[model samples]
Target: MRFIAAFAVFLFHLTMLSIHTPHGIDVLHQFKDEGVREAYNSVFHIAGFTGVSFFFALSGFVLTWSARSTDTLTGFWRRRFFKIYPLHIVTYAAGLLLLTGSAFRASDDLPGVFLLQSWIPDARVIFAANSPSWSISCEALFYVLFPLLLPLIERIPASRLWWWSAAMVAGIFAVATIGHLYVSMEYQFWFTYTLPPLRLMEFVLGIFAARLVILGRWPDIRLAPATVLLVLAYALALQLPQVYAQTAVTIVPVVLLVGAGATADIEGRSRLLRSRTMVWLGEISFAFYMVHLVVLLSARKWLGAEDSYSTPKALLVIAGCLAVTMVLAWLLHIGVERPAMRHWSVRRQDRDRGRTTASV
Candidate 1:
């Protein structure tokens, strides 16, 4: 599921390489006559936005579901820090090295270095170092709050989980309404889409969904129905105004599909996405998402600013980019992410405390 969402986002960016970069304007020129625009407007655009929302919701779900009663706030935060920051730093540095002078700003990128860019309304700040990283900023905020959020969610009566879910869902819409009515067009997308606090609602929704399943309060929605709902929501997103369509329209379906998928795992039902290959891909999907844009943008720079090619060649470019991105992702996962989690994430006190054998 993570791989699917990351790939959807990758495909969406394939059609949206900025016109500002050298020959970047011509990047999609070959697809001018193709269905790129229609495809984006109808589906890929929604996929790109909702793909990100899916990540936020899934983070909430996974963390809440796996949270241990014995874990302390510092331990939880430490593990999460190890999980994300190493890869983030590697990619953040790589992104800085590749960006053009216009795209890279020393002062503006400071916020992004710490994954705090999402709070700022200015695109220059939010998108400064690595544009896609704006979402990571939101995720970091979610991690910081999750320990606090979990206890609050745990106090809710198990039976009222659905109502809590609805409230979070409503909060998403309220964000859209505020962005639409109050924010200027220049910042509305930033306010509604990139703001960490607003996006946190989806994360909170995920937290609630996990508790629902843990408490056996979840409904009997099959994976098929949940998937169908996702498709229908995507279709509906196409007709809605862009402001409301970003994450607001598809939150429920995305969260439902996530919960349903988890429920399937719990029941050991027919699980097509459970293949070993799929699981490995899901494991590295984070690295893939983090590195793909850097890979694409770097490739474009190397291919020359004025390069143009047939749609076939352009797609071949995408394929090559994917190959390179995946290899880099694999290396990062092996060389950085896993090792950090293994070594640095656990404090000496925790390890010493967990040991079973008595020492002299």
Candidate 2:
């Protein structure tokens, strides 16, 4: 599911590149007929953005699901830092090397390098090298608060978790509404969309949903129905104005879909998402997400912007980039992510040994 979401984001970026034209001369204009363009826009324009939402929610779900009762907050933080930062720093440097002449800005690079770019509302900093990493800033905030947040969440009665979930849903809509009515378009895009604090609500919703599932209180909706709801919500988002669409219009379905997936896993029912291929892809999904934009930007630099490609040529470019990205992602997962986790996530070693002794 995560790999699929990342690929959706990759496709969205490709589409954005293809349509962007400077001086009224789009290179892709020659190949894209009006009908094709309109179809592409209608189907893909907003759908890709939802991938980020999926990720935010999934982070909450997975962290909550795997959290150990005995784990300390510092232990969790250490594991998370080692898990994400090693690859992040490596890819951040890669982005700088590949895009130095173009999108790279020294002033923006400082914040980006430290994963603090999303703290501010500046587009230059928010979208600096490895632009997709803005979400990492938000993730960092969630990690900082997770230790504090989890205790509060655990204190809530199982039966009351659904009410908390409901409140989260209300908060999402409320933020969306307020942003639409009160915030300027510029502030709305940066503050509402990219700010870590605002995005924390989505993460909290994930945590709340996970608590419900842990308590056996999650709704009984099956995976199929939950998935259908997700698709329908995405479709509805397409019809909405850009402001609401870009906000949390589909958050309800997202939370439901995540809850359903967790339910499926706990029930031990086989699902496509658990297949070997998907499992491998999901394992490498984070690396793929980190490196794909750099791959895309490099490809564009070499082959000219995506607008330069004809329809068939663009298809080839997308295919090629996808292949290269997967290869690189696999390498990074093995080379950086795994090794760092093995070496730096040392706090859990005693716990693991204790578990082994008890089981024996």
Candidate 3:
């Protein structure tokens, strides 16, 4: 799931690299006579936006999996905050510094450092060297509300909660679809697209899936057959008219993917995500995601390239970015993320021991 989400973001950047921006910053124009534009555009369209959908589904799955085991809201928030905010702040701060000299005034850099730059479009979109950080801002909003919303479903018995969860799913789809149509992306982009509150359904759906699993509702599903069904559903969703509503089309395959993860045995599905390579990628996915853009930006700067808009150049840029991202991610996982997790784990164990001693 993590690899899938990270790959999607990778594809998003790849797609963005192919298009011409208003500022004439397009790299492809440099090589336009090469005749690869059509192919590049087609591939970008297929792979790019789908990354966001994958991230939404994965976020739901991970959050629900954790929620199922959370003993209290405090622990849940503690775990989530420590896990996400540290890396997020690091990435955003890097962007603030990079943008300070050119894109933004030195005075605005301080405010941007704290993520208050989102309200200022000129600061966020134009100034921030890492424009992709916008998604992280939205994700932070999701992280804040998730601890509160997830445990609510667990509070009620399955008999009553199932209906409520289903209704909530329906309500979320309605709002997303209605909002997509009625609200302009210009005004509502942050609210409808980026904000976690509006996007809570994806995570909630995963929670309901976990609830179903706990209640023994999920079939001990076979791997090959389930994978086949998932592929078919994904194809159907893609073939549907774009006018058919975004969330409606997206939620179908996303639901299936989450369902497969919930029901399918990890060992039995050895060929899929459970494989050693995919598992390793998933493990380093967060670091890969946070640092990949940084690598691309740095590489372009180093190579004296402005942007990667041409097909060959974009491919080259992605190849270089992936190599650097993987190496950096592996290093960070070993040095930073792993140690942080271990330290947190040890502290948690000590606290539990202290509480046990007090009770005795």
Q: Estimate every model's Cα lDDT from 0 to 1.
A: 0.83, 0.80, 0.59
Residue-by-residue lDDT tens digits, candidate 3, 312-336:
6566666877898899888877777
Q: Write the per-residue lDDT of candidate 2 for residues 1-360, one digit (tens) a residue.
A: 899889988876655543231111122232356666667767887765689988999899889989898988788999999999999999988877876555455687889888899988777678776778889989999999998899888999987887888888787778878888999876777766888998898899899888888888887988889889888888888998765676478888888888988888778764788899999999999999999988877777666543444568667777898999999999999999999998787666776886899999
Model 1 lDDT-worst window of ten: 19-28
The lDDT of model 1 is: 0.83
Q: Answer with 1 or 2, whichever has the higher lDDT.
A: 1
lDDT of 1 by residue, 1-360 (tens): 899999988876666556422224334443544565455435565667889989999999999999999999998999999999998988888877776445656667778888988898777778665568889999999999999989988999997889888998988999899889999988888889988988899999999989999999888998999989988988898899887779888999999999999999888873678888888999899999998888877787678645666667777887998999999989999999999998889997766866744552
Candidate 3: C-alpha RMSD to true structure equals 4.5
lDDT of 3: 0.59
Q: What's the candidate order when arranged by decreasing TM-score? A: 1, 2, 3
Model 3: worst 10 consecutive residues (lDDT sum)? 18-27
Ranking by lDDT: 1, 2, 3
- lDDT top scorer: 1
User: Looking at candidate 1, what is the lDDT of residue 300?
Assistant: 74
- Native-referenced Cα lDDT, model 2: 0.80
